[model samples]
Target: MILSAPSKSADAPIPSFDQIPCPILVTDSAGVVQSLNQDLLLLIGSDKERWLTKSMELMFPMASRIFLHTHVWPMIFRDGQVREIRLQLLDSGGNSLPVFVNCQKTSQEGIDRFTWVLFVTIERSRFEQALLESRQRTENISTALTKSEAFIRGVFEATSEGIMVTDSDATIISVNPAFAKLTGYSQEEVIGQNARILKSDRHDADFFLATFEILQKNKIWNGEVWSQRKDGSIFLGQLSISAICDQNDVVLQYVVLCSDITERWDREQLIHQMALHDGLTGLPNRTLLMERLGQIIAKSQRDSRQIALMFLDLDGFKKVNDTLGHSIGDEVLKTVATRLSSLLRNTDTVARLGGDEFVLLLDNPENSEAMAQIGARVISIMNEPMQFDNAEAHIGVSIGIAVFKDRTSSPEALLKRADEAMYAAKAAGKNVYRFAE
Candidate 1:
């Protein structure tokens, strides 16, 4: 009996090889193509009849053919399978098309055959380029952030002014090296402490409350502040406080910048004192004396009170200067100033108007009799002998008095009136007092 091969059942479906998504080919071990799917025909834009029985190298570019001989064939023969080998094929339009080729060795009817699956790799190349670009951008951002942080830290550490950062609650969060040096407090001592730890008793509660109110409204405050160091010494500092805020306008932190200005403040005060006071006796000079007299005059007029002005010229002062030198004369004058100051009340002012000339302002002296008594006492004190450096000096004073009531006279007018009265007293015998006519 003769047996026939089983025929495919009409009811069962046969899967078409052309329906595979990837281009596929069947080849012999000699690299000649035996069959190819319709997908392969579309990929190369050619008909299957033209590719059948043709060497696979005929479809590849020169470089791809060489790579196939050197790498793909040897790997496939050694391992019976090769995967992910990239190559280019020439299409009907003569354009080079990149593809990933995977091959597996198989047997059909006891003859060795190779199956090749090729995938177009255009989208994958584009995705890989985009991934590389994204990675580079991320690296660049990280590097920039690092550099910015380093620059800020350098400024904080290197600045001469103290820098302190605190939270919204005024708890110290961080301090720079300059802050530690200025305050004499280490970072370990100040961190987590209230900012008030550095407060000196110089400012009251209202001062801090007002400062905080200004900061809340304007977001910054600048002023001079007295702060105590860890060693309990107080220093004046020019301080600036700034509020750091978030996107929602909520206060996140407070930055305090401060520099010690104690030396500068002291120097300024010294300059002011030198400008307004006499260099010899450290007493108020003519400028300050006149300013004070003006204020007193205004007050006396408002209160309907009386003020006394006395101008005195020292007698025998020039003889002392000629006999015992100007140094001894200066000592005698300083001694006379001390004795006169001792006799007056704290409210009174005595100023020297150059050599041997002095002015005294007495606030609300009782009557002309009281003014005469003060004038007599000044003359008695001046007549007493003053011993300086083992040299005895005798000097007397010629006193003139000018009294002012609630009048509209200017200070300059009252002063000139006193000057005229002084010359009248000098015309009268010296060492005597006379009242303004």
Candidate 2:
């Protein structure tokens, strides 16, 4: 069949394609109809008036619509011509008419236009069906991928573990909701920022280096980390890092997962303190006192220095408790502990053995004169008057000093000798001190 254009100049007016004996249609680059030959309209059983200004896509069969858009349109735009492309068109009666078409883009009076020539055929139904099935498969796969992405995004945002994704340089690219919540930063605040913004000073360079070394070795690393909040407050967290890489084993991004463990760490510290401290006065109890005495005795033997263990018992303390109740007696014991701690060096240890009884360990006490002077100072402080909630009270103490110069005596034996000397002090006078012979 032949397709021709209309007159271009006044002297040689060309005949229009309507007089041609072929089915042809013309359109703009955007697929909007410009004109069509009568034979073409007749072949599709449609009138020119009804089809003139509509998009060419409107004439394609429902199943072939996607193929026309995704394949035929891109082919025309890229190559500017398409040859023998199989397509389906809907007739005026709404029935499919399969045809092979050739389209070419041309310019008419400086306006871009596409001319399509179609040849209606009865064969090639199988090829059309195959194309349609392939398009359907692509659409189905796309839908499934979209749903999977939505499910994964929901879990990432909803989880309580803080999740962060960073570039290879440790610059944060994205963060989940829990990450923002944990670090007290909004996603907008942290994006493009270095992950170091959340780092606390508690970790040294070696600590971070070791962590990165673990990641390099195992491709994943997890450990305790100290992180800082947006408000500059410090917190402890359990951080896990993973190196996300491409299939070629090239590092691309890092994924970090963290959980705040500050509360748990604080509870552990409190438990440790409770195990070694007297609950009433917050001083070392018998267990910690024994440990300290053992350490001191070992040091004294190595350094050839004398260690003094002073056992002090408050004289006439029961009378105060009997008259004023145990609450006031507890206050007195706390006060005594405070006074003894204040008088000693930091290297020394003062502990509360039990009610109205305290033990002081002094290292390198110099001589027995110094030991006696310390004992007398303790007695003088204990004899001072104490005021408790509008009640004036007086108490006294008797101290026994046991000096250890050699490793002959154990901690228990030294404590026993100090206790015997304390009894001697109490027997000699109510408010005096004695030394173990």
Candidate 3:
């Protein structure tokens, strides 16, 4: 039978098998004795060597041995465990000892083993009858407790989310099967290791300090954590940690649960990118362009430096769309975006404001001459023919320059000035540039 001991306080240490308060025996599947705990050894009045490698039949009287062969072994083989069987054992002096036996079968390292817990019964026949009656009354409650414990153990083993239990000092005590699978580390490998072995070095000391501080204050912490596996791959985990405390509110252990969230995180980032970028050209949209312009303006004002904003309207794009269809026109726009992005410095910003309208924010351009040179380069590149499928398309761009020198100018006002200048450039000619008045 699988039995759960009494619930221990959080601060209490787990007792060793030999330190247990009851007599316990362990044997292989064939009833060959493997080990006996101290209490069992004392009850039998024998040393460890006497029982080692011996068949359990040697410890029992003839009647009990027959009962074990006929009833107990069959029950254990059929049910994997048995509870509350009355049995008689032989002590060193050849006296019969009556006991209540509970046994469970378990597999470890591919070998089946049986563990037995024995409770001594009173020798008087009247007392034994009374004790059996009392046991019958509590049997239902005991069975319920055992089933509940077994159900909990089943869940722990079967859950997909990783679970780990550690002492207050962050020493790993136990890890569930999911934890082993997720980390690529077996239970035996991580049992005594510090939990930091999973650290990915992505978070700083301050990050952990803040996490613990919040956990201390609230008794629980939940957040995203990046951890490394035994194979050295990093995974993002949505993690929660709870402190187990004693009656005096002293922490003794920590329970950590985690689920991999890397895919969810990547999806969120994709959604955010879609929100701020153009669908067609993958360039910054108007909203992102304006936000970047505002930041650059603020920085330029603080440093007493000049910044430039260029407005571009494609010259023959509508004609190409009208004749060659929107697909080829889209190809031409994407090609233009790539060329424009390649020509600019990494610090400069190039954005598409929908349709054939584009904008550029240049940080601390040396002078209007340098701005004109960039505008000329843009016009020259846009004039080149773009090949798409079996057709070729030609497009040109009219450019307008707006210089930001006054700290008082806002992003909207600067954009308006550049827009007006773009109209001026279109009025002068289709493929030329103009400065804002």
lDDT of 2: 0.87
Ranking by TM-score: 1, 3, 2
Give lDDT per model, in order: 0.89, 0.87, 0.90
Q: Across residues 1-437, which tens digit of lDDT does each residue of candidate 2 receive?
A: 13344556869755568866666888888888888888778767767888888888787887677887888889999998999988887777887888888999987689888988877765667676788899999999999999999998998989999999999899999999998999999999999999999999998999999999889778899899999999999889898899998897677999999999999999999998999999999999988988989998888767877888999999888988998888888888888988889899998889989988899989788898988899889988887888887776689998888887558779888888888999999999868889998
Candidate achieving the largest TM-score:
1
Check candidate 1 and list the clashing pairs. none
Give the per-residue lDDT digits (tens) of candidate 3, residues 27-76.
99889999888888887877899889999878889999999999999999
| Best prediction by lDDT | 3
**Each model's Cα RMSD:** 5.8, 12.4, 20.7
TM-score of 1: 0.76
Q: Candidate 1 — which residues are off by over 4 angstroms?
A: 1-135, 297-308, 364-369, 403-413, 433-437
Better of 1 and 3 by TM-score: 1
